[model samples]
Target: MSLRRWGAVLAGAALVAGAAVTPALAADPVAPKVTVAPATGLDPAGTKIVVKGTGFDPAANDGKGFGLRVGPAKADVRDRAGKDFQVSRLIKKGAVGSQIPLDDNGNWEYSVTVKAEYVASGTTYSAKKQPFSVFVFGWDTPVLTWDSTTPLKFTEAGDAATGLAWGLRHSWRNYVTRGGGTVTPSNGATLDTAAPNVEPYPYKWKYESSGEGTVSYTGQVTYTFEAHTIWDFTIADPRITFGGDGAGTLTAKVGYAFYGTKTAPEKVRTPSDVVLADLKLKAPAQAGDNVAVDIESAKLTAAGAAAFADFYKPGEALDTGRLVFPGKSGPAPTSSTVPTSSAPPTTTTSSSAPCVLTPDSVKQGNLLWGFKQSFRRYVGIGSGTSITASDGVEITDIDKIDGTGPPSGAYLWGFDSVQYKSATEFTTQFRGKVTFAYPAHSFELSIGRPKVVVAQGKGKLFADVELKTTSGAPSPPISQPGVELASLDLAAAKTTEGAGALSVAGIKVTLGNAEAFAKFYKVGEVLDEATVSLGASCAHLPGPGASGPGAGPGVSDDLVPDVKYRPDSALASTGADSGMWLLWGLVLVGAGLALVLVVRRRPAPGQRP
Candidate 1:
C-alpha cells in the first residue's frame, strides 16, 4: 500500500473516534456537588426573595461583588418587564453555603455563570454554569358574601290606614349609622310602597290584611315590611301584628350586618337600634269622629337587647328599658288581703271574644296558676251614677309582665327619663289629650314622668299612669329629658297614638353581661386591619448572620409565617327566637273543633243511626 493511503486511513479512523467520544469530553466537570436550598415562596408583589444553597463562591463581596443569573449564556438577566435583577443580601459561604437573592414574579430559570475566569498558566476557564427553575405565584385578594331569612310586620287596630301610615313612617329607622339617619332608609325617606325597600342595603317586603274570613287574624290586620341586603342578609321581617276579633298575634324576624374583612364572613353587631314611634291612631268606629285614641299603654323592653348586643361586640353590654301598661293591674298583687273563699269569681265575658289568658297557661303539676278576667265597667258616675264601662281590666299573676329592674350600669345613661317640676320644663305636657270612648271618665292627671307600658295588642300603643312628681310638675319625653329609652328619641317629633303591636306571652327578661347572650352562639372572632397591621412591625431584629450569594446558610432567614384572620359571619344562629318552634294553640283549637264536627256527623259504623 502507498504511504499516503495509510495516512488517510488513520486520519479517518481518528475522526470517527473523536466524534464517538464528544459527549464524554463535554460532560459537566464532576466537581463537589453544590445543592441550592429551595427558593422560599413569594408574596403578592414588590417584595424581596432569597435562595439558599450550598457551595457558592466564598470570596464574592456584597451586592455588586456577587449576584444570581436565571439561566445560561443569556448575557443580561432581566425580568419579563426588562428590569434587572437586584441582589439585596450577602453572606460568607462555608460548608453550608449562601443563597442568591431575587426580585421577580413568575417561573425563574437560574444558572451560576461567573464573569471572572480561573486563570492557570496562559489559559483561562470560566466557572461551569448550573441551571435550575423556581415558580412564583401571583397574589389574589379574597371576597366574601352573607345572607339570612327574616320575617317582619306591623300592627295597630281600629283604623287600617292609620296603622299602615304609622308603620310606613317608623320603618325608616331600622339601621342607624354614626349619624341619627338610617344607613338603608336614607335621609327623610319613606319605605318603597310597591315592594317596601329601605334602600342601599338590600331589603324587600310586602304587607297584607287579615280579612274577617281568616281563622287567625292579627288584630286590625297588619302591614308586613321586609328588608334584605345584596349580600343576601335579611334586615327585618315585620310580622309585628295586633290581634283583634279576639286575641292578637304577631311574629317577627330581623337580619343585620357586623364588622368584616375581605376574606371574612360578615360580622353582625347589634341590630341597628330599632324603635316604634309617631303612632297617631284614630279612635274606634264608635268613638266620635276626630276623637283620637289616647295611648292606653306604652312599654319598652330589653329582654332581647343583650342577645343582639353580644352579636355586635362579643363582650360588650347593651342598654335597655321595660314596658308599662296602665289600668293593667299593677304587678298582679302577689300578696292579697282578700280571702280566696269569700271572694266572688270574677266573671270575664267579652262581646268580641272569650277572655283567653295571655302567655298561655302555666303548668304546675296538673294545676296551672293563672287567671283570665274581662275589662269590667265601673257603674258609678263620679262615684254615684250607674254608667256602663267598656274599658275592662284582665289581671294575670305572671310576674314576667312587671316593670324591668334598674337600668343597666353599663348603659350610655343610667336612667330611662328625667323627673320634671313643671310643664315649662319640656315646652308642655299633655300637648295632646288622650280620650277613651266607652269608659268615659276624663280627669287630667299630670302626664309627666308617667310609668308607661304599651299593650301587646296595640301596634305601637303605649299606656302610662299620669303621676305628678312630688314637686307637682310634668315629666319630659325621653328625647328632651335625655332618657333615650326604646331608642325612640329620633322619632319623637313623629309621635302618634299607636305604633306596631305584638302578642304578649309574658317576655322573660334575663339580665347579665351581653356575652352571656352569645353563649348560645358560636361565632368566629373578627379583628380590624389596624390590629393585624400592628403585628407586622412587632420589633424586627437582625438575624444571627448575613444571607445571600457567597454567604453561609444560617438561622437568620428562618422567619415565622405571617397570618391573616377575620371574624366568621357564617356561624350558626343560636338566638332564643332564631330557632323558635312556636306552637299556635289557636290553630290547634280550630283543627280540634273541625274534627269534633266531623265525628259528630259521622254515621255509626254499619248501623246508620
Candidate 2:
C-alpha cells in the first residue's frame, strides 16, 4: 500500500522501467484499468477515491480523459499537463479535466481527492520512499497502473514539524564566528546535529538490512574552532552513512590540543574515528523514511583532509551541504540522556529466529552455590578474616547442605559465559571473585560476575557487586554492577541428556536484594542451592577472560571435553574462551536456530556486546 516505497536510486521517480502497459489493442490485454479505494489511512482532510476505468476507448486521447495523479511506484507517466503534479486532477474533455460521465461501454466511475499532499506530516520518513502510483493516462496509448492492488497507506500522524534541517558546512558555518567557538546541541540528542540547525529534529529508523541498499542515521554534529594553539580543534560526534549510488560517509569524535612535538605529544589528542565528510547527493528530498540531503559541495576524504593542518586537499571542495535524513529514533531521549558512544546505530536482525543450543549443545557447565550461611559466618568472624577466591572462584565444601555445619561455606561459580536465551531460554554466566574480608567490621563484600537467567520455568540472579560499609550503616557500602541477586524457582525441572552429562535439579532460591545483595538478607529469604554443570563447548564458548585476581590461563572443569558430572565435582578453572561470543552464542543455541533475544539490558560495559 502507498504509505511509502522508494528505490528510484536517484530522484527521477518512474523507477523499475515504467510500471507497465503493452499490447495497445489486444482486446482484453489487461484492458484499461485503474483503482484506488481508501488507498490507505490518508487523513488530514484527504481520501475520497473511486477511479474505476475498464477497457477505455471513447475515442482515446481524442477523448482527453485520463492522467489522475499521485506519482512514483510503478512509475511511467509520460507527463503532459498539471505541471507533473505531486497531486493533481485532469480527467478532461469538457472543463479541461474532471468530467466523469462516460458509459458508452467505455465505462467510468472516477471520484477523486486523495490529497493532503498525499499525507506524511510526520512519521520520520525519507530513506527514500515516495512511491505511490495510480494512473490511467494514454499519451498516445499505453498506460495503466494502480499499484498492483489495495496498498495505499498513510494514517498515523502526530510529530514532524521539527524534522532535521542541517546547515553544517559552508566552510564550517563561515568558521564559527572567526574561531571563538560555540556550537552546542544536546539531549534532543545531538541537539539537531548542531550549527543553527534550527527547529529540526524528528527522525528514527531500524532498517539496516531493515531493507534496501543501506540506511543509517542516528545523528550528531560538532565542529569547534580556534586559532594557532594550532586550531585547538574538537570535532564531536558525527557518524552518518548513506550508500546507494550517490554514496556518502562521515565518522567523527576527534580531539585536539597539539603543540609540543615528539610527534605532537599529548596536549589533548584522543577522540578517534576520523574519516569525516565525503558525501555527494546533490539534490534529494524523499520525506517519510526521510532524506532531505543536498550535498552542494562536500569533499575531503583522506580521513577528512588529515584533520585540517594542510588546509583542504583530498578532493578539494569541502562542504557546502545540507542534510535532513530520517534520524531521531523517536520521542526517545531518556537513557539518562543518550550518550551511546555518541550515536551508534546499525543493527537489525529478528524475524522469529532464535532457538540455538549449539557449542556441541553445551558439553559441560557449572554454577553450583552456597552464597549464604549466616553471611558466610559473619564474614569469617573478625580477626580481620580474609577469604579470597580468584577468577574461577572457590571456597567450597560442595553443598553439604551448607547451614554452617562444617566448613561448607559454598560458592562454586565457573561457567565462563553462557546466555543462550531461547531453545528453552538461558542466561548462565559465572566467573567468580568471592573476596569477603573483615578489616575488623569496616565490612566488605564482593560477588563478581554471575548470571542465571532461565526462561519459562523461572529464573533470575544477576551479579557484579562489591560493597564496603562503615561510616553509619543504613546503606553505605556499594560498588554496584548488575545486581538483582536471586528469585529463581525453575519448577518441576527436567533435562537429562547424557553420553556424559546434562542434569536438572530442584531449583528454588529467594532473596531478591537486601541492601543490594545480602547485608543481613531478608526479602523473601530462602537462599542455598544452585547447580548448572557443563563441560567443553560451554567453557571455550569464548576466550581470554578472568581478569581480576589470579587472572587468565584456565580451562579445567575437570579437563572439559564431552561433559558428564554428578554428586558434584569439576573443581576450579573457568577462565579462557569467552569471546567468540561463546562461538556465536552456541551458534544461536541451535535448534531450528534463531536470534535477537527479548529481555533487554546486557550490552554495556564497553557495551555494543
Candidate 3:
C-alpha cells in the first residue's frame, strides 16, 4: 500500500471519531445539575444557603467557573433593578451564593441563586434559569401557611425546613391600623377576606409599643365591619404578656361577619380609635415579682359600644342596693348591750305623777274578737233586719296623746258592720250588733238585744267581737243550750315598753231564761270552752320627755308593734256543765233503781216469797 493511502485511512478514521465527539460537545451542555441546600427558608432573614452544581465547565474562561445570578430573573442582572433582584456572583462546583441581603419584607420567587454561564472560544454560553430548590424569604416564620394552592397547615418544628416553598409570593397589604400600637412591616398588618365565608387570614409579625403606656391600657382588640349594617366585633388582644416576655403570642380571633359584595354597605367607614389588638410588654412589678397585667380588670373603652347598645339598653342602673357583706370576726364590745326580757326600765316615773293609766302612754289599735253562742228565739219579723253599730265613744289620736297630760278615759272604739245571713238572722233574731271599747288591760263587748220574741227553738250563733289583737289560739265552741252570751277577760303581762303577750282567762257565758233552758240543758250541758292568747302589749305612746310610742329609750318613731300570741290550757273545765251532767246522772240513777225494784218485786228465783 502507498504511504498516502495509509495516511488517508487514518485521517478518515480520525474524522469519524472527531464527528462523533463534535456532536457530543455541541449538544446543549447538560444544564449544570444544581441543588440548593435548605430549599426554603423564613422570609426577611434566615440561615445561609449553599449551591452545588455538577457537569459544569470548571475551566471555562480560564477557571473562572460558572457565573451565578441570585435574583428574581436573568434580565434583572442586565437592567440594574434594585439590589434585591440584581444579585450576580461567580460560583464553582460547590460554591455558595453571596448572602442575598433582603429587605425586611422578603421575596418569594428569588430563583435558586445558581445559574451556569461560560465564555468558550470567543462565544458566551449561558444556561437558562435552572430548576433548583428554591430559597424563599417570607414575611412569616412559616409556622402556618395558607394560600389558594396550599392547604392550610401547621408546620411542625421538625418538618419546617423541608419543601415548604409554595404560594408565598403575594404581598399581604395592610388593611387597618388600630389599638394605638405598632406592627411589624410598619403598617403591613392586613386582614385577608378574599375566600368566601372563610376567616380573614392574619399576617404574623411582631408588635411593638407606642406612645400609650401600660397603666391605662385596655387590651381589647376589636374589628368594626359591616356586611349589611355597621357592626363591631372583637378579635384578640396582642398586648397580652406573660412573665415579662416581649416575644408573646399574637392570637388572631374571628370577629364580625364577612362583607359580601351585594350586602356590603355603601360607605364602610373606618373607625378612628378602633383597636385591632393590644401590644403587651413585660415590665417589673412594685413587689419585685413579675406579674402579668389583668386584662379583665383593666379600664378600657368599649371597642364596640354602639353595637352593644343595640342589644342591651344603656344607662340603666343595676340593682345592687340589698347586697350586704358579712362582717369580719371580732369580739363584741363591752358597750354593746343585748336585749333581755328582764332589762330594767331606762326611765323612772316620779312619785308625784298620778298612778292613772294614761291613754296617751298606752298602745292601742283596732282589735278583733269572736265568741260562740247557742239559744232559741222566735222571729218577730219574717226575716231579720241587719244593722251596723259602733261604740259611741272616740279617743284622741294615739300619736297626739301625751303621757304627762290628763288621763283620757276616751275608749278605743270598735265598730262592726254585721251582715245577716238567712240562717244566722233567723237563729239570732238579728241581735248580732256587736261593739267593743278597749282600755289598757280590759275590754267591754256589748251585743245589742234582739228585737224578737222568745221561743222554744234551738240553734247555734257566733257573736263577732272586735278584740285588740288576733295573735292567739282560737277558743273552743261555747255550746250551752241556754247560754245567750260569752265574756273574755284579757290581762297583759307587765313590760317597761314595747308590745307583749296578753292572757285571755276567766271565760264565762251567761245563760238566758235558765229555767226554761234547763228543760233541754239538764242543769249542766257540756259547753265547749277554750283559752285564747292575744298578742297585746303595754306600748309607751308619744308623750312629754318620751321617745315616740313603742320606741325604747334613745329611739324615736319606732311605732311598730311586736305582738306575739301563745295559747296555753285553752279552756277551763266547764264547772257549771259538769254539775249539770252530775244532776242528770242522779236522775238517771234514781230511775234505774226504781226499775230494778219493780223487777225484784215481781218474782224471786221462780218462787213466791
**Predicted structure 3: lDDT:** 0.24
> All candidates' lDDT scores?
0.20, 0.45, 0.24
**Model 1 stretches astray by more than 4 angstroms:** 1-163, 166-182, 185-206, 211-237, 240-250, 260-307, 310-609
Q: Order the numbered candidates by lDDT, best leading.
A: 2, 3, 1
lDDT of 2 by residue, 422-491 (tens): 4356666777778776543455678777788888878888888887765433346677787887788767
Candidate 3: stretches off by over 4 Å:
1-361, 365-387, 392-498, 501-609
lDDT of 2 at 186: 41
Error of 1 at 454 (Å): 37
Instruction: Mark the 10 consecutive residues where model 2 has the least summed lDDT.
Output: 542-551
Please state the error at residue 132 of candidate 2 in Å: 35
Q: Name the candidate that leads on TM-score.
A: 2
Rank list by TM-score? 2, 1, 3
- Per-candidate TM equals 0.17, 0.21, 0.16
Q: lDDT score of model 1?
A: 0.20
